[model samples]
Target: MSWFRALKDTTRSGLTVERKRLEPLIALRGTAGLAVVIAISLSLFGPAVAAGSAFGGFQAAIATFQRSWRPRPELALASGASLGVSTFLGYLTGSHLFLFLPLLGLWTFLAGLSWAAGPTIGIIASSNVAMMLVTITLPTTVAEAAGHAAMMVFGGLVQAALVILFPVRRWGAHRDALADALAAEADYARRLRHDPVAEFDPAPLMLARSAAALTPRQARTRPAQLHGTRGVAERIRPVLASLADPAVGVPAEGPERDRARELLAAAGSILDAAARAIRHGTPVTIPPGAIAAFRTPDNGTILSGPAQRAADRLGPLLRDVVETAGGTLPEEAAALPPAAALRRRLTRPRRPRAGPAARPPDLAPLTAAAPAAPPYRDPGRPLRRPTLFELVPAAVRAIRREARPGSPVLRHATRVCAVAVAGYLIGGALPLGHGYWAPMSAVMVMRPDFSQTYSRAVARFGGTLVGVALATGVVQLAHPGTELSAALAVLCAGLMYLLMRTGQLASQACVAAYVVFLLGMGGETWSQTVPERLVLTLAGGLLATLSYALYPAWETPRLRTRLADWLGALGEYAAVVVDHYAHPAGKAGPEVRAALLKARDAHIAWQDAIDRAGTEPVRHRGLSNAAADDAAHALHHLGRVAMLMEAHLPERDATPVPAAAALADALRTATRDGARALRERRVPRWGPVRAALEAWDGEGVPDRVVRRGAGMLLEALEALSDALDTDVPPMTVKPAHETDGPREP
Candidate 1:
């Protein structure tokens, strides 16, 4: 996913446990400024000249203020200054297209470029639009502009003060990230129980893992305390994945088989409880009976070796979940009888390779292992800080990419610019009152991809209609005084920000009301604006939607290419990680870690590409639904295998793993052939990778962990190969075990 997706206006799924639980807390960001407007109306301030101060606070709070000193003041000050300057320029440009067109072009270029920098730029984008549109119809002299500028800065300062005055815990979001992943894992377990051949959605778990991977780099969390969160998830993925495959997991159809399912379901429940605890940053609570009932190897009905093995492998994972919840041991576990003699009698010593094997990560300390997983980073070169200087260069780059013929971003930019210019010219030439609205809507609604553009345009159209209608009713019902109007506007602004991440319709509606009240206090009457607002908004929406339909970024033509991109990245990531496994010099070194991180980034892009491709008009979609499903499932399965391998690397090389290297090369070749196959309308032979995996020397590797990991690589390769031939559909793929197929580890 791109930075823009992460900055989603509303929180996706509303699953974040850290999100404010109370209504007032949700509205605080908006009210911080309303309080200022009230003071100004009460004559607590000298004049209405500084009214932009309220908006300044409103903008800064939207930046997600925290107790940290680094970004809050910086964002607040920058936004206030930008708002002041842009507002002034826009007002001046209102009288001249010579100034407006070029500046608008420059701002749009900046908006396009800022997308790579992350969600902050999105907030800045809204600010840019507001700066232009808010005062176009109002009289703005140099003196008024200066006063408004200062006032907005004052509002930003007020927001900063409030942030400092009211502090919240910093780990809330981080905790939720880990919790979300665990919960998703639990869900996966439940799915495995219900349908042995089922494959659960990996998006949520992937997103959560990615977010949790960043905890170390962010503020407030103790790095050591939580380092193992992702690592824990990494180890657990294969376990859950194994369960989803009945051939390698479930026992025979009998009471023993029933017992295995019950235990797995219980394990899922415990993990869910653990996720809840982590989400709330509290101790996990569950009945002691839940833990007690998890005891395995029961019923005296001998299960098939695979079923028995699956049950045995599942026990430690359940215990790990309990440990992660920061709860006391179960009553039975609290005072366990010593098993030293029994262990000596039953355990077989793992054979040494040439030298002593490095100690594998202990499962006893589950949280401690979480940090061991490689941290996520950009797969490509990291973006430089966005600046005004880069605007021209970025534009040049955009032109060049699009010049190659049909770049999505370039196409989108052209669409936006064209529609914007048309709206501007049409609005100004005709006496459409405050004609900027048409162009504003046009620019706001058009997106890089069709789905977002279409969806947003619809939302904007429906939202504006309702929002403006409500504002009109309220204004007519109560011709309130300036103070009351200002207060209402402030309140509406707060609600808008609160709903931004929760509901787009609500946010849009609140914003419409805010605009109405804001203008009312600024000496504009609702009666004169309603009809104009409706017409302008409708025109903007229509222009945006039809413009895109005419100049479409058709999905079918690009599906193969997008799929190719994902396959290529997947192969590269898998190859690198396997090579590292074969010849690991240091545990989790920068090179291997970087490769793994790069894979994560590629996976995000691939996922987005596939999703966007799916949304394209099916009539023109070149790919088959079954093929699309296979591609996604294979890619996701490979990604998890890579992640699991990345987390379980040994500290030092015992012997160079030739098998892993061979497997890596085979994958690269397959990937290359696969891409070519797509281009040539043919399927690639995937036998080399499967052969390489099968050729692995598990016996030559002394470390059980390393050997098991190697075996898993082959098993996954076989599964993916089966998928390519349509021999094993997602709903019926063979189960992967920790060892050779059908063989006990």
Candidate 2:
């Protein structure tokens, strides 16, 4: 009884898992079924009708493949080649049409090659028309001619069906990907607000790119698909504008008012960042004093001095809304203090004497025997930016650019054509008929990814060899007669269906084997053809390799310029972040969100550029690497700061102080110090002094809380400076609690 119960439970669990896995497939089944129905309908029609439909279908499929296969051109070409080979072999042996086999093989190979190279539907249709004419003259029997024609038509129809079904299912996937990306960004922002140990990271940026790449058909929409959920500009525009309008007074309700006020504050910060990005491309540099003030814990009232000054600068309507709402703002709302003031207090102004200029040590030396790293992993350092070669289509594009117009592709095509011509010439000279293996091998070897090409070549060779052996055995079992031949033909159709469903490579082998067997049953022996095909195949591969090596191709250049451009953009983005923090509540948030999106787009572009750079030849490597790494680090830090500012804005604004002059002086000083440090190539130290000033400026927070938060921020800044070897300065300001009531400008 116990065992039986356990068995029942296991069965139930298995059923649950199966149902879960099958759900998505079931949802997509309708479209898949539609494609299958079209293929089956075409097959049911008589050979003549099927032939007409096949021509049109093949043309459409080739055109679509060209447009969609930009990133994976080799795969498209291979698929076409596989189709042509299967069709030719099917007709040669299945219908006992030995005399027409060589002609059919050549025609199919040329047609497939042209389609793969240029993808013109019209050209393919024309090729089919020629094939139809040849079929009438070359086939000794009507049935044989009809069977070959039908194979061509069916092959074309299948290609068309697959293309139509793929895109429709991708749209929903993109939406889901976007939602996941936004949620991840929000989570990262929240973590920055709560965790002091955490530093900025570009994982979020990477996630965003991945999300963007997903096709829409695959995306699933959730409630968070609304722009507001992602902190996008569209979400904050209304709230920011409302805050500047006096008519919409702060709500009298409790939680409702709180939510409204919080939204308004967030919007203000976003707008401020956007405005700053427009004014200057670099990130807004935060004074150490401002960081200290926000870190203070005693309700942040001690920081109100600079906050009030910022409020005074706002238009009347916005000031009224804040006052009436009884809402506080973030400490960063006070314009950042100067870097010079912070630097003067923290360290001497003189530059460090140059020896080695504090060079960072290289962790790994170059070695021939060292294992190469995977594309996703950094070649050396943990946080290094990816090189261009790691990316796919970019590498191919870069190579293409090196050659003159249409050189690399055209050169390859020409070599393939030459191999076929040579094969025909050799056949004529020897009186053994044109060899199909030479041209077929050329198709197998043409690939952008070396690994894929290698695998396919092996598979093709193995499958063909096995197929010929199997044909010998089958012919020995069944004599050459019409009834046996017809039975074998039916068996080939079943094999085609199975192979198509299994995989292209596997199917190709199966088809080849069936063809060999059919030929033997028709009185031709595999022992007579096997050795000849192998030799021809070797000839084709050699020609293909020669063409690829000799073709004019572009070498990948150093990607430093692209990386530098991205770094410059990131600097600008950081400046915008500072502006967002400095702006008065209700004035900065909307615009800041817009700026964030721009930054996100810029990062995506940088990734693409890097991918392109990596694929280039060994020359000009590691050019933009340093700049890209620095930019990534900066963005991670800025994102964290933005989250913190958003979380504390309301509490900080409630403080009242009169330290505007001191804060501004401190900010100016810090900015100057930072500029000087950058020039000197030294890390600046200003966090301690900034913390002291923040402790002194704020009046609302209990002295201990203000002191502790300020201390933490100061320590954090010091760590950052040490990590990046760059200096930052402190800002000065008076405590907000010491301020008199609202002051005149």
Candidate 3:
């Protein structure tokens, strides 16, 4: 009697726990039923509805998800999970009840649209509830509501079982991703060293370069193990302070202090180079001078001579890399060639030609080299915030140019709306007796960014397959009752949260698991139903792909026009640098910096646009083998000129030559050539400008100005000519230092 009582008590306890779990589900079912009745009654008694409410829900969810998900993988996972969870909760509350089924179908469709736009666990749960409610409303029976609720309980249980039992491996995947990124960076860096003007915005190249520099040991370490080396040079501050004190006895601090400072400086440079390389995707070579100083024997006294020598060598290199990376140049430097002595003379400053009547500025009167401007001060810190204003305008322009003239926004919106409507009508008309999948297909097919479209489709399919399989297995084994069902619901909620923390794949898996649970909970004894759900999902995916591929919205194809515009802007900037250098006595400040910043921003944008264009499969053949190569070369020359201008500003400002006219003439010639190259799709003539700048005598021009302007102009002309000629194939544009040896001081 005692044993029997104990058994009965255990059974009762289990039953009570199960009953408690079922309460929320019951309430959820009741709410869903009530919502459907309201929707139907409104549809029948009032004006006929055309599934607006359903479509709206689908649109809102897609917009919300797309807006939130970014390129960063971690952020993508988190946002996807959150949306999933939020969606599930909405179903539980029966909020937006009429739209719930539509959203579910939409989620299914988006999964096919792109890997990045797939449905989450939350979406699956919401869909299940919505479908159940829609079915229950067909009979308008209280018994139907109870039956659906019971089914939901069963579905939830099956999902819970899978989560607890399944072992998901994530660490390996993360490591692989990191490794791939690093490898890519390394390859890019190697390429940049060989060719620097191949592309603009070396950030990708630099990132790859920096990652390559990392030893295998470093690469293998977990993210947690790799302590952020940000501001690591700050640690050397105390040692620098100790060495600065003159009061300390020379004997006590001499050799050790000297060695320490040398190492610290070298280390600092290396760290800075590493940071720049990573941020800009450019390679940065350490100067030999710094290496020599760092290798000095340990001595306490500050090794002023060696340290100074190393610093001197490093200065020019550092400045060049920074300027190149930033897309700025000085006024007078010759086009960059092998690092060697190639003296160029400065021409006298010519007065601006007075309209058409003004005699061309006289080149007969050669001037002494212009005085150099003050050495440029480092901006101190790198610009971190990406300029969105510039990006947005460019994007808008591209979109407008690419779109059919007039009401692009309206056109796009109309097309999207049409797709949605078509999906809805078709889904409603399908004999499959479920109208959820059609609207889902529409949502998936409509996307602005095409890069992730394929991946999204694949992930969606894979996730669904796995989810259905798991659901099928659990339903067979559990034979879910109220207790089992309640347990499953709670488990699903927890898994949804966990999936949100994982990645897109995991999140999709959780959703799939939940869907499987729903199928089982509805008291459908046929396991074959899982296959039907899979087929429905695939159908939705296929429809989405067709929509994207057929009537796709595209970015503008006017890449050459954009490139020409940038070159023109660069010419104007070059003129500014030359003008500043011509007046040696002029003070240098924010103007130069501002010009440099603008040039940098423009260069980056140019590169980004090119990348986008390259990714379009239809345009790839055209882009890969077109005059883009020549155009890129010309831009590279412009970039070098900008760097040289910054480097020689001090010297240029001090020069006294009146050769401003010659400088202006050369700039005009180069600009015209660049324009012609773009118009005719041929290389520009760079020889005349190069020869003139190189041959000009700096006798009357100030030496400082001559040295600065001559070097920059010569280099600019060479680059422009080379770019136009197409004799030299375009290489990836690297940050200045990465391509060449360390920049000259």
Candidate 4:
């Protein structure tokens, strides 16, 4: 990509407004917290103290809005306390530039390292550094600084108190995450009705899994409805796929296909109903038609073999979903396998017995209290995330791992630290009244990636211009007193919260206006601050952009490594799935689950690298665009084949296919060698995999699904080999896989 194209794309990205639903109530609540802190501080110590303290409430409110599983009040408190400490330390050295510059560099570096923890921590830590620069200029003496710092902490305390006193939709984020996952599955079910082999992105399920992780306190207080449903959702995806596949399950043109369509439609409706119930904490109303379809006896007859089995599995799972949604689920119900769970209560017996007919029980809300059993854990435990405090040592280890040459985090840290110091020196030398604005802008806008850093810089500068103009006009027209300015500042803060989800441009615009009004309350004139702020902000943005251009950590160079990682993970996943066919009694459920998770993570990493690489002004040296696209296409099919095989895994006591053992070994060996060859920039030859597939070429295999998928897998690998060869013309390339066609009965 050329520099001009990169710049144009990033600018468009910066200007793009995401069409997300606005949370007015939550934003209003956050604004109210800011209002209380400002009102109280203004009453006690007048406008200047209020101005300094508002930063605490303001930043803390932002922190609470981060996408973290931790409690919102806890986030608010931690953000507040951290900002206070940063401000106090910054004030200590504010008198001497010699002392402050060193402190600034060290603080900036540490903030950069905080990314190892997670984006939430990294964002909060970066804000801490930015606040240090802005707040240190407010206090004149050490005693005064202590008082100001205490007031800031008090601001955070006020927000936390407000959260406890008037909670809004408690456990709301968790509910939303769980609901989104179910909704995605519902959509997938609908799509599969037409395109049985349609692809489903697992991102939503992954998010729900992350949301399920809880602190001990959260676990104790969790709502019963939120428990166990996630596991049921996980089990449903495979069943849905298996039932829809033409080769293994239903026929393409027959009455059985119509029955399959009816089941899928009913499943979609049930899933949709479940999602709504889970989201709003309401009673689940299972559609009468959906229940009737499941109860239809011909469902068992028309859908025979794998299709029948999948239909059987899906009915019980959906029942659990409805029961769980109505809060009527037995706490110990999760311990039962999906095929056995809720069978007597929700599902009618498949055959009539020599007994009286009983009506199927309605999923009524049950209030009986039993000791909650430890929840059914996922095989790989991929959903488990460390608590914030627990992440400290892990974060330290990550930082240490990145403390080497060519580590992107290390390069980013060094780049940011250098740019901040330089921006500060330049801003001070130019006689800017608020020199801190320069470095603060630099710190806030400079991210580890080219796209974000550039987009944010563009957005920040544009937002500042609009904001400063609007704010200065207000001050000039109204000639408002300190109290009015403070009120205006509160209003602007509210607007920022409301628009935060829209885009960086909208939120940053409000932030600019809020800051202008905030500083106005502290007796800084619009004339003195407005022009200086605009100029300094531009300088900071320029410094950040220029620094990246000079010392870039291009994702293009790491593309091969990321691709190799994904190939290896996908190979392991395929091997585990195939191994299940070879040794049915081994029950490699945990291993398969773990391998799938690792493969998913690697896939995400590779895609992210590609996106980052696309926006970088660098040549694709080793891997051309055409090659990368072809390779990714091939790998995607390989993964889908593994997934399809996993859906048809044999039961524990089922007969093992001895031929699968050789294929599994070949997959492991070939992919390991392939990854090594990829890293070394050589065209990998999958001789072993090809040989293994040839051995099964003409055999009358009992396990048709495994054999067919292995053929598809080998085809994908061969295509991958051609992609990496570089000798093949991009225009002559052919895809290994095709959209699956419906089969006749």
Candidate 5:
């Protein structure tokens, strides 16, 4: 892609409006917190101090609004406390340029490195740097600076307290996530009724799983309705696919197909009803038609053998879904109180009993055999979020890991530090009084990727212009007092919070206006602040954007490494599943689960890398676009085959597939070497896999399904090798450290 097209696409994306629901109540709460902080600071310390402290409440509120699984109060407190510390430290060095410039570079670099932790941390840390730049200009002694810092912390505390006292829709994010997953499954089922081979995106289920991970306290206090639904949802997806697929369950078209379609339609209805109930925290009201379809006995006519078994498996899972949704069983709707029963009947009309209502003999049990609180437990690494205290060490380790040469985090830090210092020097040399705006803008807009940095540069500049113009107009026309300025600031902040999800351009515009009013409250006239801010913001944005082109960290070059990682992870997952087949007594053990989780993470990472690489204005050096797509498709097939095998895992005492042992070992060894070969820019060979499969030829593996799945895996691997070998040429790429050596401090 050309630079022009990349820049154009990124700018359009940044400016695009997302029609997300506005959180008016949450915005009001944040704005109210800011209002309180401004009122307190003005009453006690005057408008300038109020202006300085407002960053705490504003930034704290913004932090809480980030898409994080952590509690809102915690995010608020951390944002406030960090800003206070950054302000105090900035004050200590503000008197001397020699001292302050180094401090500025160090702080900005640390802020850049914080991205290694997560986007939330990176964003909050950048805001801290900006707060420091703004607040250190307040002209105060060490004692006075400490007092101002304390007031800032107080502002954060106010926001945190408000969040704890008046949370709007508690656990709302989790509810929406799980609801969306169920809704997605419902849609998939409806689609499969027509197209049996319809593809389903696992992103929603992945997000639902992420939302399920909880802290120890959260685990104990979680709502009962949330438990076990996700697992049942996970199990239902494969069953739906199995029931619909022509090769696996029913024929292309017959009475069995019609029966399958009925079951699918009913499943979709049941799932959609459950989703609605869970999302609204109301009683589940599954359709009476759905209830009847599941209870109808085939009598060995409609769906037989595997199709019948899948249908049977699905019925109990759907029942489990409704039960876990709100414990509103099909048979118990009439037993509720008059109003409740009426509501249930309106939505979940009673269905006639099909038989004794006894649970099917072949029905799979729920989590009864496992620990009681399965849903609330901290899942494995990908979904397991660390507590704030735990995060300190984890963050430290992350920074240390990214400290080496070739690390994108390190490169970003270096580039940001360099640009910030240069922008500061240039701004200071110019006549603009607000020299910090230039460096602050540069720091805030820069990210590890090209698209965000460029897009944000456009957003920040455009937003700054509109914001300055509007605030200047308001100031000149109304000639408002300190109190009115504070009110306007709060209003702008509320708008910012409300539009937080509506893309960067919109929110940044409000942010610009808010800052203007904040400074106006500090007694700075529009003339003194407006022009300086506008000019300095432009300078800073340009510096940040230009620095990327000079010191680029392209994802295109790292595509092979990411693809290799995915291959290795996928192989391990396949081997683990095959190993389980080899030793049926083990079932799906922790190792298998862990491997599966790792592979999924790797898959997500690979897709993310591909996406990032696609937007970059660089050539595909090692892997072309077609090759990547083909390889991705092949890997996806490999994952699906493994998932199918996992769905049909043998019973604990079932006859073991002796051939699976050798096949699993070969997969583990061959994929390990294949990944290495890919990394070294050589075509991968699956000779071991071929040999292992050949050894079982004509011997007939005890489990034909396992053998078939293993054969599919081998085919996928071969296809992947062919995809890579067709276009990939031999090349020696330098290690990241060698290519981008770390600068000496």
Candidate 6:
């Protein structure tokens, strides 16, 4: 039961979007689109190769239909080029065993190199491999090979035309990314108002980060500049978090704190307005004093105290947001609240906090984005990259990068090439019919990491057996003609495409049906091909699994390095943000942004490593899973706090706080020492961090500013220490009232 509960704790069901609910409509569109292309080809080639052309059309559509707006010409060209090269290799390898084996290994090896460019290029490479694996074992000459490749290209052209004509959601991804972030911010703000120091789930923020990943190169800009809607979303998270810092005394026992909470609530209202404005693409209309209210502080709060500091931090950020959001500041900045009632109707109420088991669905915010530039391009225009001329140099560079001994891509590619060669040899040395399926299956099943490889192998084998039986049964029952078989193939292709994002098993099942029906249209009967396909697929999966079992890409060896990397980056990020607070001179420069990006990248890398390691074999060395997870959770919490610290980073130069500077230095030292300890196998000291915060007396104005930041930092650091030093489950994070008291490290 305990293990089951832990397993549940780790599930990220919150991140998933329910695509299955919309699959039926997606399937219909996909089927109709592919069928139209295939129907035309049937008239030209009839049954001889109509099936191949149709399958090509299906594959083209499936591969190219991503969240972003792809240029139709680029899709047609990339697909055609991949098909052309893979076809040449397939034809070359079909006859000559001596030359074929070595070249096949080399080709697979090179294909792995494609990953360095990006996943977009990586997908193209993998598709090329898959196509060739199917084509190479075919009984065809050079002339027939050209015809087959042309048919594939023709199929791609059809899909491209469909895309151009249909013109579906072009800016959907960017829109969703922005909307999700704002929604999450609103949710976080709502929770903050309820319980300023509560341990809120960080999953929604993670979801927003993941959603905001598809940044357009054209949209890249300076720190003060608005890159995209995502940039605004990123900026607002810290503001919301800082406002809710319990140790900052924004909600502590005082009239001044009460006033600060009201201001925080007002700031939240502005966020709501911004979210709504972005959602509808309207100019922002905040309450008259919303912007000005933050600028002019109430004199009742102690000078440079928590209330004054929170207001000081939120002021410039609010002003920047107003400019970015295209909001107009009223001439009389003091007439606040009720006057902004016109805009109030446009905003939404906060959602009720979800139960623990409630998976995150979506968020809608009421805030605005800081817009610094006009749109890079018209939203209606489909974005395109520089074409294939640049690919040669990129591919060469990728190969060079992958040649490094420690490169993950190099290791993975080597494994794939070795496995492919082995499967090909085993198939050729036996009596299996068109045994290339074995090699194809092996390559397809072998993922870069162990978890994916094992999972995919199981899915491929099980889905194939089930699919073969089901497809064969349907074919025997219907005994359809050539045209009907072609239709069935198209239908299967469409359904497979729709189901791909929903479930791997369902997609694989449809793939089996599609293949069976497609080959049947080419005069290969189900009875003759089903057994061969089944046997080869099973063999391929087994071979792929056994290969990994023998020489596993275990995450244990990489886990320590990743953890150290994350800690180092986190420390740097925290220190930098702290320094900016201590010395807010030129806060609008690029240095802070650069540091934040590095930290975010490192955090992502560590999480990815943890996930992959979880999928490896159970006998992990160097560290246990529970300890690793706790460590990651600790770091993630630190990262969240650091992000908040960054959001409220002061904009004007201030007298440096000695205590704050000391704490900053301590963060740097601890990170360096901790990383070294983690890597070299030692228990790192947390004394410096705890001691620095304790000795910092909040005596004067400057020290008070430092105290606010130091207080929050100490609490976060202590949480990190607790997670690292103990085996306790994470309980509610209350304010650490014992910062000045003796503590166990």
Predicted model with the maximum TM-score:
5
lDDT of 3 by residue, 92-173 (tens): 4333445654544444333222221123322332233223323332222344333333333322332223223431221223
Q: Is candidate 2 or candidate 5 better by lDDT?
A: 5
Question: What pairs collide in candidate 4?
Answer: none
Candidate 1 residue lDDT tens string, 413-493: 567767777777776676757777788777766666666776666677667777888888888888877877787777788
Error of model 2, residue 571, in angstroms:
6.0
Summarize candidate 6's per-residue lDDT along 466-492 as a digit string, tens digits. Answer: 778888988889998888888788877
Who is ahead in TM-score, 1 or 2?
Answer: 1
Measured on C-alpha atoms, candidate 6 has an lDDT of 0.60
Determine the backbone clash count of candidate 3: 117
Give residue 211's error in model 5 in angstroms. 1.8
Question: How big is the positional error of residue 690 in model 1, measured in Å on the Cα after superposition?
Answer: 5.9
TM-scores of the candidates in the order shown: 0.74, 0.39, 0.48, 0.89, 0.90, 0.77
Candidate 4 lDDT (Cα, 0 to 1): 0.80
User: What does the lDDT read for residue 108 in candidate 4?
Assistant: 93
Which 10-residue window of candidate 5 scores lowest in summed lDDT? 366-375
Q: Tell me which of candidates 1 and 5 scores higher on lDDT.
A: 5
**Over the stretch 1-745, how does candidate 5's per-residue lDDT look in tens digits?**
9999999998888777789989899999999999999999999989978998898889999998988777788889999999999999899999899999999999999998988887888899988998789898874789878977898899889999999899897788888899999999999999999998676777788788888877655666566566767877987887788788775578999899999998899889989988987887776765567666754345146787556667766765676677667653433333223543344345433322221333221111221111111122212223456777788888887788788877888889999999989998998999878898999999989999899999889988888888888888899899989999999999999999999888888898899999989888888888888888889999999999899999998888888888888899999999988988878853437787788878877777787778888899999877899999999888887887787677667767788778889999999999999888877778899999999999978568765567777888999999999899865666675333112111111
Better of 1 and 3 by lDDT: 1
Prediction RMSDs, each to the true structure: 10.2, 22.0, 20.2, 7.4, 6.4, 9.6
